[model samples]
Target chain A: MALGTDYAQQDCSLARALEVVGERWSMLIVRDAFYGVRRFNDFLAHLDIPRAVLTGRLRSLVAAGVLDKEPYQQSPVRYGYGLTSAGRELWLPIYALARWGERHASDGGARTVFSHATCGTRLDIVGSCPTCCVLVAPEDVMMRPGPGALTELRQDPVSRALGRPHRLLAPIEPLSETVGEQAAEPVG
Target chain B: MALGTDYAQQDCSLARALEVVGERWSMLIVRDAFYGVRRFNDFLAHLDIPRAVLTGRLRSLVAAGVLDKEPYQQSPVRYGYGLTSAGRELWLPIYALARWGERHASDGGARTVFSHATCGTRLDIVGSCPTCCVLVAPEDVMMRPGPGALTELRQDPVSRALGRPHRLLAPIEPLSETVGEQAAEPVG
Candidate 1:
């Protein structure tokens, strides 16, 4: 089933936002970016998305100013994707939606837990720090695998690396240079 | 252009949430439900969405427990759709995404402004009541056309009725009972 990318008739701002981030795998890609999964291989490994779909989504995100591509290596012209300020502003919506899923959709507890890096207070359902009484920014939050997280999830290196607590927006270490090279070309 | 509906390999809660509401027109339908457009024709008129798409999305939502369909007219067995508790919990994410679009995507100001119904203080970007320093629930939020709202938008009855200030989750007056009957069937 073909879904149109643009909501031509709707004048709502939500419609506009959807135009940018509302594709099938787009939001999940953004979630991975927040988790500091920058390189193409990491996203591919963690998401298991088709290479062509990942390439198209990354291109669209970069064009929409949600993610910026910059060269990380000089010789082969390998680039890493990072979220722009506009993209970082999406944290609230992403967090809120994930919280909703944890409460209403997930049978077990949250698969991931977020806490205020400074106070270590777990964020509430609305992404607010109860102890600080403030909405925690993505930069100020840390994520850790929760009780509901599957113990033996994926065998991918990126999935393994994500098991430990990490601050949001900090880069996840790439598994290897060869993995990036292998992921450079989009496969059918 | 066939986008698969499920992210089977992704183990994230956000993926789970998207599995439920991440379709092309699903979030917009949820947005209309928040605006209290209960009847099928009202949604069809206001959204300008294909009747088939609306029907499919609504059915999906009901199946996901985001909406419930109940009898509104008995003679012909007509039904009206309303958001369930699980659906109402989506307000935070919806508001956050709309706010992000208004700030980064819109050229003019907001098309809609949400305020704390009690204190009449405009909600902050994160949907928090600045005056009370509390998060406002959808029930207690008031919505009105903002400065950037186009003077003359759609000519549909639902669009015209939405021009004035209305409380979220309060039903919008149906244009006509007959409109419901006309839209009862889903078109291919």
Candidate 2:
């Protein structure tokens, strides 16, 4: 569907915003950033995306100011990507859409569970902690695979690292240097 | 940019959700439905979308059960599209995304202002009525043009109808049968 990239002359903010992040794989890239996948290779590995496509999405995101790239490894000049404050603001929509997906598109269970990091309470559908009685920001949320998570499909280190609870926005520390990209075995 | 229509193996609820609504004009079409757009011509006029493209999107949405199609005119058997229960659930993501767009995509001011119909208070970025201390549902919300609205871009009846404060999800009644699809003049 060669629907043009921009919703030109729409006179709508959602249309304008869609021009920025509505491209395919763009929102998923943002979701990976929230899940702590930072390096270009990690995103490529976990998302099964074409390397050039990943490169373009990252470049577009950085240009849109939704992401900021900085040098993490100086030897080869490797850059790591992280959400800017503006990008972080996307958490609400991400959560809402994910929750909607879980409700309508799921095979039956949560793939990952999110909780308030402060008190360890699961967030409600609208993203408020029932126990804390407050909205849980992505930075303060902890994530782990849930019962409905398909544990057998992927074996990437980034996917393995997400198998356990981790803080949102924190860089995912791979299990070990010895564990190759496909070293991890499927637990299912 | 031939990103395939589906995320083949990504294991996330968000990924599953994106497969359904992440297409180029899919979300915008859904947004239009929420804004009380029904009938084929109205969507075509209001959206500036190709007729064939509109037909495919509406079909896809209906197949996914995000929208329901029914006959509103018996003589010609013309169909009207509206959000299903599952479709109405998309309000959260739409609101969240639109709010994000209002924050980041705007040139300067709001193009449309959303408010809680009960108290008449503008909704917060998260779609909550601060006055009522509750999340405002689409059925109970009202929408009207705002300071930044570019009134001159299009003069279709749907656009003209949206100019006034109106309730979300109610079928938009065209001003008159005499108003041809392009009968109205630009507000600017």
Candidate 3:
């Protein structure tokens, strides 16, 4: 979907995705929502993001269907932000990024780690196995575009690039492992 | 570790990660590297990122250990970029964000989907078992901060405010199990 500025204009799915969440304070707000912070004041206090920018981002997110503005109380003051169903699903991205930082960019001794409640051990962000606990590989996975693909992808680039009958939900290859190998490994 | 900035600065790891990756086009550059775009000219052609900004971001990322500069060819044309182990790991964040966009922000038909190659079924990005296909939960997880944590975290405002001992990386909490319920899952 096109945003107001062409700065975010790109036909790529990732670019299309970034148009909404790629701004500076956008994901941070999402992070707070995960922390169960529903109040606007709490977001401001925790993030230290400028009020105007926070207001604008919150508005944009609300407009984009990522947040819902609701009244938390009445009388003197009443209001807060809550993640819509759409907004809450962002957990993967946030966790993935945090796990990445925890592993690659971290200073070696992690101050925190993510434990898998089921497995009862800290899970590797990139490769968590529900069956056997080991790192998985790309050939181990494939992808079909979700329900959110654009017409341009179905008709143009994907069709021209891959020459397959485009089922937006069809399984394509997992390029991460193949391309990632040359790039390096454990991309968490 | 301190970057010479005041320890009182924002102590959010996501923010610090953003401080590095959140710059315009940095993630895109990493994305391009995944696509096998190595030369500066290739990055210029692919991203349309301003040369000065690209140069600066590349230099900074190199300095920060994400990218390694190597001589691909000599005789006047002597530079190319590649992912160090550090850079390769950035895929998690990019994938995470893209997944978020697909689920929350993308219009109908706007998102991409993933499937496990072994199962030939859609993969849940959050906290699913790769083998048994079981979903993981928040109480099942734990958090120990990573190496990149700010020393400021031990200081007054941040330390006191965020004084919780455990930094939990739980499976995003589930909301209602409605059709779009995945969209509302919260992570912390």
Candidate 4:
């Protein structure tokens, strides 16, 4: 709660939650992981964070039990970061907050619309499947651009891949290392 | 979004939402508003924020339409901040995120518990009343110290008032000016 304290002094659960994800780019990093961006390179390409900050966030998330760091490649020892079961519980808050943004944050337009993967019915304001009348888990949800979708706003490989309709939590295979470098390269 | 960017460059609603409330202390300010701590002194007493920082957050929240700045005392012209409709919608995310913390962030015990003011049924993970089978709005929710609550952690008047069961959005009348100063005094 203090300028230097990580809100540890507050005896509130919200304070505890914010201590974990309230860092500048931490929530966005968690959002990226939910979008199935597992590799560090892919997250870097999709987000505009510096490499060092991204590294710290990933390490912190892993340490907090929100993300699991696993090796996906042996030739170069590449690592993939995915949400743990506890981390996956974060989907509710993430979706609820993101949907709040969709309704009130931007102009009266939706950028990404979420739907029930099984029935294809769009979720309600709180991520509940109106047709099924139950809250839909992230794995059972699907995402795609909506009325405010800007396909060309970002040309990064991860962004391009995200422009398509995809099931939440399913890994979006990151492009090859060469293509990834090209996308991450400074445009200037 | 870029580092300098308030996530304005992103086409997503989540980015827009973050732009308004992602700054440190913003969400906590809003949380206090939901708990009926409206006056500047009450907020200052409840939160461990510097005076200038709290002032800035209040102004920004007013500019963003999350809080309304209204004159409550006219002799010296004191103002009170209350949540607007848009701000009230934040309860979904705030409550959900806090529940997530109660589950994963702390030692398996809840510091605070929320329930439907009408039925007294505890809210589900998503802020839904299991008995009523509907999402409980902020005004309909009641908060109380749970089994894990540490009542002595904070003795501020605002915190003491919050220690008792209270409804969301009802004002917690602040102590008189002299009592406020006594509580705000720095300990030797």
Candidate 5:
């Protein structure tokens, strides 16, 4: 599909998605939080990100509800960051990408292997039945749009993604029919 | 475990992973490319990223072998991008993260949906068995150092990740191995 213009000018679902989480360091911060790195210092130590960048990312994430900032200690103590339910849920995508990078990006030697904690069999992020050994493809899945989608924003990207074929990480279906027509209109 | 240091500087797998793809807009750029976005202007239209930023990101992705740049049309002599075998493999992690985001970040009402072209069922990125409906957890997965790992690079992140307990998104195994050694050193 052709990339349309005025992405910033449009209020579309993908755009909305990008607006919140698309900035630099956002996902990494979320990824670090999931790995049990709870403090700002831990994020810095783990990410090699500049302090300003980390701080900005953290603030944005908290504002976006991806993270919950709580006080871990008091007096001379400090606040620790943790994933809210929202943050915790990002595990799948992070794992999926990490597994992909490990499998494809490495220099031909196995860089890392993922195993099933229970079965002891190496796990595949996109595998079907470790026993049956089927690989899952995007077209095999469906997706439904989420809440942050524009109420009155309908644009090409959203239309094409919603109506036609696109490579999605998983299967998604639009949950709300009300979103269809109303979302297509331009939002002030 | 801690959050306040240069993680990239430390001997950590997550840090190394970040070094490769941790910069802002990188993964998303990869994601859009997979969605079939091919041109510079298209990415800008789709991502709302600054033109310079888009150029830089695309260049980095190409350099990393995550994307390939070729001429889409010779009339205007415009270039287009497509995934190499290496790029397509990123689907694993992209799916993982998208699933995580949809489950955790999405409100109960789906804003959109994805249909697996293979299964004909709406699939979640959770690595669950559709037939059995079992959810797979990170603890359920394990990673063994792979072939690409450079044993000669004693301080490599992959080496460190293989050495410790880490989630798919963030590898924390190096802390005890690397930091423990640091802690043991004489504190002059």
Candidate 6:
């Protein structure tokens, strides 16, 4: 992808941030991680990316300290990837961009809605709770599919599992082994 | 850069946002726009990007409604690109990402410091003023070169002009026509 030139000769902090997370599939993977899709199989099922690409993104994220890869099961050495503190800090930028898209880019309305988990009030454009008058932390935010979500476009088990309301950063249970295997095929 | 595949099958708002501004030099252009870089020659001088790439990015941003190109001079039909309301909405995400970079990516401290223009208090990590106890809008924020700024690396007139504190979104004067012609040469 010629990602190496992501920010050539730019001495700005934004350029540095982009250098780490600006790759094609990188931010989506981080988004999935925030959605609690920890395991490789879950990320593979939820995102339409090649396995090698996903692996490479995950490796880069881990190396950059955005995600931590740790053994979840030792029998065959399965690892789970989760957001680090640095990664959790990305929630604001991610949410801000998503809200901007919902306002400007989408005719389908909000595909997903984020709210203050405690008060159940939808977050403002900047990820703040209007009712509480404070910025909602990602951990304190809950997400649910909104009316604009295209359910028909997604059939993977992870998508189905995400239909219900979920808190950001809470681990998602793996889909059944049968469903996982069936959805393992990568889509271009 | 194979940027074509950035949002291949992604149906999320973040993906939509990235699709528009995720190219190699797009966000930096947007950042420069926020810093009052309206003239083409000023953008060319401030950003170390190829002239063709900068032109392409500016055209795309204008098409995407993030920027508006307007005639600033009638004699030569010269136009300046300014951020639209939708583009100004990007301040939160841009500031958030830059703050994150300053926190985690840079060892040289903040290259630039953002402050509340009204009270002159530096903004918090979330771009809110601690003294004002409110979120500072982009226009109300001021930026100044910080101790860690690498002024030596940039000799562009825009860089020199930015050395003094300036309010975000205030128009910056272009270099003299002769200097503009001299600095028009693309730098690698």
Per candidate, native contacts kept equal 0.66, 0.82, 0.37, 0.70, 0.24, 0.56
lDDT of 1 by residue, A51-149 (tens): 999999999999999999998779898889999999999999999999988888777888999999999999987788999988798999999999889
User: Which parts of model 3 have CA positions greater than 4 angstroms off?
Assistant: A1-8, A116-120, A126-188, B1-8, B107-188
Alpha carbon deviation, residue B154, candidate 5 (Å): 50
- Alpha-carbon local distance difference test for all models: 0.84, 0.86, 0.52, 0.83, 0.50, 0.83
How far in Å is the alpha carbon of B116 misplaced in model 1? 1.1
| Runs with alpha carbons beyond 4 Å of true place in candidate 5 | A1-22, A48-53, A73-77, A106-121, A126-188, B1-21, B74-77, B99-112, B127-188
Which tens-of-lDDT digit does each residue in B1-188 have in candidate 3?
42211112333345556666765577777765644456786567556667997898899789878888988667886788887777866755665565565555454543334333334344456534356565433222222222323323222221221222222221111111232333422323
Better of 3 and 4 by TM-score: 4
- Across A46-95, the per-residue lDDT of candidate 5 in tens digits comes to 55678998888888788878888888668977877777766655555555
RMSD of 2: 3.4
TM-score, chain A, per candidate? 0.89, 0.90, 0.60, 0.89, 0.57, 0.89
Could you give the DockQ of candidate 3? 0.15
Ranking 4 against 5 by lDDT, winner: 4
Which 10 consecutive positions of candidate 1 chain A have the poorest summed lDDT?
A: A179-188
Residue range with the least summed lDDT across 10 consecutive positions in model 3 chain A = A160-169
Query: In model 4 chain A, where is the ten-residue run with the lowest total lDDT?
Result: A179-188
lDDT by residue for model 2 (A4-90), tens:
367886888888788878998899999999998889889999998989989999999999999999987787798899999999999
lDDT, model 3, position B156: 23
Worst 10 residues of 4 chain B by lDDT: B179-188
Per-prediction DockQ, in order? 0.63, 0.76, 0.15, 0.61, 0.10, 0.62
Candidates 3 and 5, the one with greater lDDT:
3
lDDT of 4: 0.83
lDDT score of residue A63 within candidate 3: 87
Report residue A153 deviation for candidate 6 (angstroms).
Answer: 1.0
lDDT of 3 at A50: 73
Which has the greatest TM-score? 2
Give the runs in model 1 whose Cα sits over 4 Å from its true position.
Answer: A1-4, A174-188, B1-4, B175-188
